[model samples]
Target: MKTLRAFITMVALVVVGYLAWNGYIEPEPDGDSTAKPTATAAPPVKPAKGVTVTSFRQASRLLKVIPEDRQAYLRSYFGKGWIDADKDCRDTRQEVLARDSLVPVSKGCRIYLGKWLSYYDNKTWTKSFQVQIDHLVPLAEAWDSGAYQWTKATRIRFANDLKEKRGLVPTTTSLNYDKLADDPQWYIPKVNKCKYIASWIAVKARWSMTVDQREKDAIDRVMKGCPDRKLTITRAKIGLLPFAAGTGTSNRNVTIDSIVYSGRSEKIILRNTGSSPAKLIGWVVRDEIGYGQYRMPKTVIPAGGTLTILSSEGRKRLDAAGNPVQHANWGDVWNNSGDTATLIDGKRKVADICRYTGDNSGKARC
Candidate 1:
């Protein structure tokens, strides 16, 4: 009887050990397991640090230089209010709070307590209400630029755009109120001026919005101060709908327009042939050799617009030649002998490819 009992106990121990090894039961805090853990919600993506000079120059060139046309302000035109566009049961405001909060969210869409860093004033807040969601490009400003002509649906998307980080920012309430439809000339806390201007221009370019002469001049003046920074605006996939009639397709046709493989100024040029503006925010340019890829900065290519990307060394050389170099810098991009330059969009789709053979020759057949 003792032997049988001992044998049964041993079998039970083996079974338990197998189960534990296979993760049939939850392991203790320190135990290891082979089973994959269930996935949880991903953290919110942080906003881009600052845009490059190349991207800002491109966006500036595309901006319409006109006088501001004041229009009547109507909050109702944009939509009811903070919407749960993502179907996450949380409104846009709550989403922003949850994203910017230092502490984890407690209960159902409520961020009762958390820490927030305000970019506008470079202040930190412990209370939720102290921080307000700021529309980087105000609705009235959009209207003056051309959104007044947009459909009600489009206007709502622009107003409540949670897709692009630049579209909305969490700032101190006082600063939000103080910035009332003003251009970049308004105070943006000296430290954050570059990022602030980049976000402003990016939001405008992404939405195909225009800028008046004063707005353009202000942006240009600020950009002159940040010669090395570039602005690359990637298009937000969420909250955007199909273009209205005669607005053309949402697809942006970007191609590897040209490549300068040889000489002192080696660079790749891209062009948007589509009727709608193309956001090159997440696009990648690459070469076959070394498989080196250069991710584009957040920028927009207006219809029929062209963007030039130069290597870091090339940009420095060009800047020395008295020409204001507006080119995205990819370090040592091309092979002198021969290489292939390919353009890939945000969706991982191949947009265009250019190839060249380097016989120590001047310029590839791109």
Candidate 2:
């Protein structure tokens, strides 16, 4: 009887224990749950550093093929006339005149009397007044190509570009008017037809400008018949005209890239999207409200590089080279809700402006 009782008690105990274990069950404690898993963030993709083309054929191919972005391109959209980047009295016209003239500037940055050979008509010119400074890629054509999307400051630069030798030419007023905004296909120069086409392709490539099917076909047909030579082209968006105006040798385009409105790490970043260094000295950056003006120092932003302007402490800070970082105490100036940053040249002319509508992203690429 005692043995039977012990066996029965042990069985009862085992059943109770099993039931209790199942009733008060806990998870494996491996940190797994029914919640959805968080996603891993992706790394940022960098922009193209730039491009180097070996020939006119290659350069021509480099142009992005797109239809004309025809907005009623106003002449004023590109800003008034020329820029005196060097702060010299000579604006872009006189600068180009002084440059293209076979003789030195007749007087004080003026090209009153000089010798010039017009590549368009293949005629030599004597008086400066006889010839006008012509944009190889006319502004109208540029707007039709891709510049309609550019900023006012950029348009001003393009209109007054004296940086690249191929961009601006001294030509007779008659031919200048004749060419107007026509591409090589429509308006062919009596002399240097191939040369004109090459330059057109080059300018288009340099500025990252696009060509319509017709424009592309015209250049392609021209290239096939000519002896091909290597042509180095850059993709800076028609490389906005010149560094500090004409002194810039390479096609230089600068843009107001991003802005961080507040905090100790607040900053406004400007990037030289061009392949050449851009002179930023004497340039002014200001918020929409008048007092937030910060003048750029004597500095040049190298191609593909950046100029970061800090807030507050940046004013007294020195770079690694012992130069001032060129900054503004913009925390109080830049409104987090919405704001605008305008870049003006030494002449107090607007160069570029970046405007942002507030967002959670914490930075504005206006």
Candidate 3:
């Protein structure tokens, strides 16, 4: 019994010693416990307001043209005095660099891209080869703007004359290529149309050009985000569209999502994909069966929206007056002669329905 008691006492002493050492002699937390760390997130990517070709307008304030003969005479007499070859007035390249660049460069009258940034692809390149000098008013386009009526001398003067300082702009080579020969009313950079319209206006004004109502309507769609019809194209005035809560945005608050297309055959449908309510504006349709591809507007859809598959065509569609027709939905087979409808958002297309097919026969798809 005495030995057992001694053993218990020794054990108790050991336990007490161990507890004391653990409680008082511990290592520090390396300050990690005391400090709170912050989260590092990527900066927001704000939707480029007027980031499109429209920004070019702010710098373009001149209009009217000097007669080509007078300009040539000035060039001949001055001999690089009044008119400098490729150095006279602002060429499209210099003007664009001055307008589009974040950091612009110039050597006397010539302007070069200090850094090549492609707005269409959201890409940044180091060399000028990646970029191109785009003509806001293409040569063919210049013809439409009244250049075709002019003499060759006048055309040449207009083509390269810096005095009018109307055409030529440096942009991403790809973008320029894609936009070549297309009208401003038809093709505009999806990212910043307001900018495109303004730049378009600037070129038109400089070259004494005019726009029809249809073209004006397209421009209005983009300008809707601006404070008014008369919007100033600048970096600061671009505002944000209200998206759904928790949709998540970058530092610039541009939606991380995009609206896409889906369907097969000429009789097709469109759908809204983003979390927000997209405005269904227009569409593009092509049918090999005599119905060549066409661009037209859906009467009821809004800009920047989507179109649901409310109905179809190939399957014996209906008319506007709720009537039935023998050959309603198969529009491509009967009219256009194709079997595909590729609906492009923000584009226009034509839809056909017999007056007696669906609810309303002889009624076209609005």
State which candidate has the highest TM-score.
2
Span of 10 residues, lowest total lDDT, candidate 1: 241-250
TM-score per candidate, chains pooled: 0.49, 0.51, 0.34
Compared with the true structure, what per-residue lDDT tens digits does model 1 show for residues 1-366? 999999999999899899999989756554455556668989966666542234667766756676653443456658878788888788888888887777776668666678888987789998888999888888778877766446668888888777687788888998888887777756455667878888887888777777877677788888788754566776432233222222222234888777676666577777778887776545667777533556554556667767777764333222332222344444556666778887776655677888777546555546
Q: Give me the candidate number with maximum lDDT.
A: 2
Q: Residues 1-366, candidate 2, lDDT per residue (tens digit)?
A: 999999999999788788778986443444667655568888855444675756767667777888874543457667766778888888888888888888766669666888888888888888888897888988988988867545567777778766567889988889999888888778878778778888888777777678888877877777777778767655554333332343322222767888876676667777778786776645667777655666555577767777778766444444574333555654456667888888776454677889877655778886
- Judged by whole-model lDDT over C-alpha atoms, candidate 2 comes out at 0.72
- Model 3 Cα RMSD, 1 decimal: 24.0
- Model 3 per-residue lDDT at 1: 100
Query: 279 in model 3: Cα distance from truth in Å?
Result: 57
Off by over 4 Å in 2: 1-53, 234-366
lDDT string, candidate 3, 1-366, tens digits: 999999999998788788777895444456676655667998966656533232433333323333211110112211222123454576545555555556656655655447756654566655556787566666655554444234445555555534332245546777888887676567888775655666666656654544555555565566567443342322211111122111212211111121112223323333333344443222333333323333222222223332323122432333454222121122233122212333333322132212112222222232
Show how many residue pairs clash in every candidate, following the order shown.
15, 4, 53
Worst 10 residues of 3 by lDDT: 69-78
Clashes in predicted model 2: 4
Query: If the candidates were sorted by their TM-score against the true structure, best first, what order would they fall in?
Result: 2, 1, 3
Please say which candidate is ahead in lDDT: 2 or 3.
Answer: 2
lDDT of 3: 0.43
